[model samples]
Target chain A: MIELSPILVTLKLATITTLILLLIGTPLAWWLSNTSSKSKVVIESIVALPLVLPPTVLGFYLLLALSPDGFIGHLWFYISDTPLSFSFSGLVIGSVIYSMPFVVQPLQASFDMVGKPLQQAANTLGANSFDTFKNIVLPLSKRGFLVAITLGFAHTIGEFGVVLMIGGNIPEVTQVLSIIIYDHVEVLEYTQAHYYSIGLLVFSFIVLLVTYSFNRKLMVRL
Target chain B: MIEVNYKYKLNNFLLDVSFTMPENGITVLFGPSGSGKTSVLNLMSGLGNDKNKENNSKFILNDRVIDDSVNGLKLEPWFRNIAYVFQDHRLFPHMTTSQNILFGFNRCHSELKPEVLIEKFKIKELLGHYPEQLSGGQKQRVSMVRALLSQPDLLILDEPLASLDYTSRQELLPFIECIHKELDIPMIYVSHDIKEVLRLADYIIIMDKGKIVDQGDIADLCISQPLLTQQEGASFILDARVTKIIEEDKLVELDCGETILITAESMRLNDKIRVLIHARDVSLCLSPPQDSSILNCVPICIDEIQTDENGKLRVIAKIGEQTIVSLISHRSARQLNINKGKQMYAQFKATAMIK
Candidate 1:
């Protein structure tokens, strides 16, 4: 039998979190960059809250929220007669929130840099708002989107406390690489922890190096 | 008709302006810097406005009252049917020239095709090139063409040539002249250069200190002594007929009521030309001098004299039915003892005359 390893679990969580962040964070980033509301500070603070808050704190909130009697969990229970707590889906939700900033900040900065003239010119040329975004905004922000997805996927792979708090190290379902490493260290499995730590360190370093190198190359070309 | 009235205050630079123009021909917003020329264009285009106000400013097109504060009427920039040629000529950096031009025309119903305009504006060679590859003049030309392709009712240009070099400015002038002649859309051309205004503007609006100081025909400003007295750099344009050309001497004689000889390139024998003679180019002599290269000497009576903005006296002279504007040093005025009713010879260069 194949040992459903920590590496496989980490990969699954990263992929799921990256996909969810892409779907949800893109519109949020676009709105944050374009809208001129007075509540911009509040909205920005909320999106960026995960960056400063401890992962355990965020996870604790999610754990409470996803329990059977908790607000979101009760709604889920009413819909499906089961809470998302201790489930793979709960871990995915926690990872998505934890990695949202990695997906959104790059996109916001890129959208802001693109300026209004191109969009204004397109509008005067009779393209509606949606058409303008599709043709102009999306194409121009292609590099930013690439950076966002890469950072988000890599960021979710490193999550520890958030996944542990919500998913509770359930084998085959919630025991990701971070939890496996924590379990190894707690049981004094020094060799396995060292191997997993080196693997994660190398993987994260490669992802970040690629991001910086690609960003520098793009800046020079642009 | 097109009418605009708006007031905006930003960081203590208050811009209060109002103007009305017919819905055809070019109406130039001629002014010096800090005169709020571009601010007026922005107001018309609905680009820059304080968010606090509802932007009740009115812009009327063809008497439809496109914007009216009292009636709570306002149209979005797309529906307003106004096209702006910015000074920087903000072409999309990512698109080719053809794509940029076509983007606007794809929405326009006008019979003016992109191919025809590209050929007419001589941007055919630049169709596949990106905007960064084009020179400043080429970009401005494309900008005008792009705005035209949008088929706007009002074409607004905000100092489009001010950023280009002299040669590029010269290269772009003919295309602007072509558009001025070929198109029926009303244009609001903004420029600080007096020469450009004289060349293209049919109706001139002189802006100063955020106010419409004067608005009239260029000919009227050229002939008015009171207006000339107020101008810091007053010059005159003459409606002259080329009576004869001395091909032997490479000189053309223009009959500006009296004969004014100008050294110019070859032209038709009897072509009517408009000559611009700067006030600084003219000197006063009590009597016509001999053996001087100043060939365009005309005997004239000083009709009026007044001190201008720089505290220098400008003398208005009348030779036959035509008036000539001259600027002389205050000491020269005293040294020559020049005043109204004094007859003096106006000596200036023939080359200074621009046809």
Candidate 2:
């Protein structure tokens, strides 16, 4: 029987994380775009912290929190004995945290570009807030949302250190392509490592190419 | 009635303005640049609450308290039953003409169909077009219709025609005039153009440097103080009885009071038409020249002389109760020794009068 490929785990984690991020990020970005709240700066600073912080620092905190008898682990234990760490779910949580800025900032910037005048005009026209956002703001800022999604997907696929801290190597579960390639190198299996490493290089390049090209077309249309 | 009493300071300009406008006709707020005309429109529209709050004023509309500093009553813009037609014609670029019109309807009572308005505004054919596709006049027409479709209690036209070209303005003026005459809603029209004010306003409010310099009926204000000098320079409403059309000279003869003055351009023999008389066009002559270039010289008494801000002399004359203005140099004022109780001939430069 053929062995299950290790890369499938990373793909699943990236896809799920991207979907979750889009759901939460769209509204957060919309709020950041339209809100007059004085606390916007504070929220913005927090969203941006993940972008600039060392990946290992985030991994260290998440690892401690998700370990058995830890903050999230103990709470999760009340529901079930199984802790979140060293599982597929743990990698998803880590991926989402690591890839958040990629999803949110683009959406916020796009929403900002949509501006207040059009929304106010929409409101004056008898549309409540939801209708205004759906009809006016959404249509206007679609390109920004697309950019956010592309960046989010790409960023999630590239996560390594955070996933490593929470998700210990477990083939078909948590042993993703990056960790698999590392394991291959540690075992002096250079050929297998070369295969996985080359695959990642090509994948990231293609994703980036798609994003930049789409952005170029958007700029041209604008 | 709409009453505004507000005082605010912006940069070096202090805006202290108050006026009570009639509820049923077009009340024009006329002023020069920096006269705070736009500010008044903004305040009335709720787009200017911050400034209005800073100034601490009151705005009452139709006995409904809109902005009252004492009571702390300030309504949101959407709640105000006043539709503002801005000078820029802020049509949503992403929206079609029909969509824009529909937007206005959405803000208003849902009882009326928006298509009825589209038919009324004569924009049915242009509904599918975006704002960028329409001409300036068409866009303005669309904007005006949009404002009206909202079914506002009072329409606010903030220089709606200010951005259009001359021909476009001419095209749109009749629609505005018709709206004022035929529509049920009252309107507050703001403009600095005196000609527009004269043409469209039923009641005029004159402003200068953030103050109400004068306010009254257009015809009465034309004949009254301060405003008269400016009007005189370009103000003559001649009730010309067309005795006969002199086709040879292409001139119309107008009978004003006891004088039958001949104008170069003639009208149909029995038509009574109004013509404007300009003050600078009228010259003072000690005696009427028999063989001269001056066509219409009337024998009259010099009524009085008033000076402008620049101290230029404007000689007000009387040929019955009708007073005519003639601008002369201050040097001429001294040389002619022009005084109130003096008799002089009022000679006019025929071409200075425009419609």
Candidate 3:
């Protein structure tokens, strides 16, 4: 039988991960766009690492880091007195790393595309750095933000290998839609797997359809 | 007075210069391409100083310190209250003309009315349109209004007309002149165009090879530095007032030291203007000739004569209090017996270049 908890958990995880990515990713993306430091290439490569690295390899490191005695889990245990492994917070951390490039790359490209000339022009006209970025840069980078948000949310929803490695398969806690599909296929429950699979397919298509149609309007305005 | 001193080093080019400009009127920063004119303006405005923190630079305007590297006191660009009009007219693409002009004015607490500049720059009808919808000249005009509404203490124009076509440039010059005539704001105008320098400059600063070469008043420098008149090799400037207009002949009479007539249109009486006369155009004669086709001749006494390296002699003379120069060959100088204190008539065609 089909269950509702996996879909709800998947949506919740994707929403929280996307929100966290945007919070940290904006300044990181902006720095990568404008910085000329020699370390820029190194940081960029690290951010882009997830695109090529297998999810199992990334999950292995994350699992070790989130264990009761590991670096991240030790800190959380000191604060909350609870183990981080097999917890929703730990799933969030893993998803943030897995979805980072999807959010940051688009934002960086958009920031670079905004260029320096208009920013300099704004500076001459008595707009401070923050004021210029808020009024000029942010408004011009609308398409970038849209793409980053959509990709970040969708990629987190589709993640399977990393969740399986760290989530401990705890239903209504760490079990997400993709992990449930894997569990169903393993037990030969083809009907249940087909439902969630087709659901995600339609949902991703609708999200992209809304974004691209909105993008066309923005292009005409420009 | 405004003082600027910078020991700037960029790549292989090093520019170490110190100079003071008058606190009022337009000071033209004239130089050839790649002579660091724009760099100097950027320093004065406190922009593009990111990589040059180690170098010493100081900019003081009217006794207020704007930038002092020694003290580590550098005012940011937004706090400087110095508006800049770039050659490309960098108006924000996302903004309408009204919003772009208001960007600066709203940020600062200034009493300058935007409507006055709007009407003066003729951008009232264009306020609703975005910059992309406007023509090149129209975009430049809107940008000028945008800068002026800020009510800057000093304005910097970096070849504001350089990007426009001939007709657009001609159309924009009068608006720039209108700004000079109406506003008392001191301006630093940068250009490689000499005609622009002659028309707008109250003081001139010339730069070459990342250093200031010569600096003076426009009329004085035109004679003292012959190379400034790059096209004709030598020229002179006359500040004259229109005394009469002969509409039938399509001529306007100008009273400098001597009254001269030139074919001009849309001139009004008592209108003050600058006239540029090429040294090669003026001919010397022992006396004024009535049978000659030239319609303008003025009596003058030669003050100085020098032979240039081009095997040509340049004669400097005075018309009332103003200076005029004539370029002639050694053969012609000897033939006419031209020398200092020699009284003679200077004859030239009526169609001298007048601005």
Among residues 3 or more apart in sequence or in different chains, the pairs in candidate 2 whose N, CA or C atoms overlap within 3 Å are B236-B277, B250-B264, B251-B264, B251-B265, B251-B266, B252-B265, B252-B266
Question: What is model 3's DockQ versus the real complex?
Answer: 0.85
Clashes of 1: 0
Q: For model 1, how does the per-residue alpha-carbon lDDT over B245-267 read when each residue is reduced to its tens digit?
A: 88888888888788888887766
What lDDT tens digits, residue by residue, belong to model 3 across residues B146-197?
8988889899999999998999999999888888878988999999887778
Better of 1 and 3 by TM-score: 3
Q: State which candidate, 1 or 2, has the greater DockQ.
A: 1
- The sequence of per-residue lDDT tens digits that candidate 3 reaches over residues A80-150 is 99999999999999999999999999999999999987898899889999999999999999989999999
Model 2 residue B57 CA deviation in Å: 4.9
Q: What is the per-residue lDDT of model 2 for residues B26-138, given as tens digits with 9 covering 90 to 100?
A: 88888787788888877777766373346378988888888887888877777777787878787777778988888868766756667666776689999999888999999
Candidate 2 at residue A50, lDDT? Answer: 78
Clashing pairs in 3: none
lDDT of candidates 1 onward, in order: 0.82, 0.77, 0.89
- Candidate numbers, best lDDT first, in rank order: 3, 1, 2
Report how far residue B95 has shifted in candidate 2, in Å.
1.9
Following a full C-alpha superposition, what root-mean-square deviation does model 3 have from the true structure?
2.6
Candidate 1 wrongly placed segments (more than 4 Å)? A1-8, A190-199, B9-14, B32-35, B63-65, B119-125, B165-167, B198-200, B222-233, B240-273, B285-295, B309-311, B319-322, B330-337, B342-347, B352-355
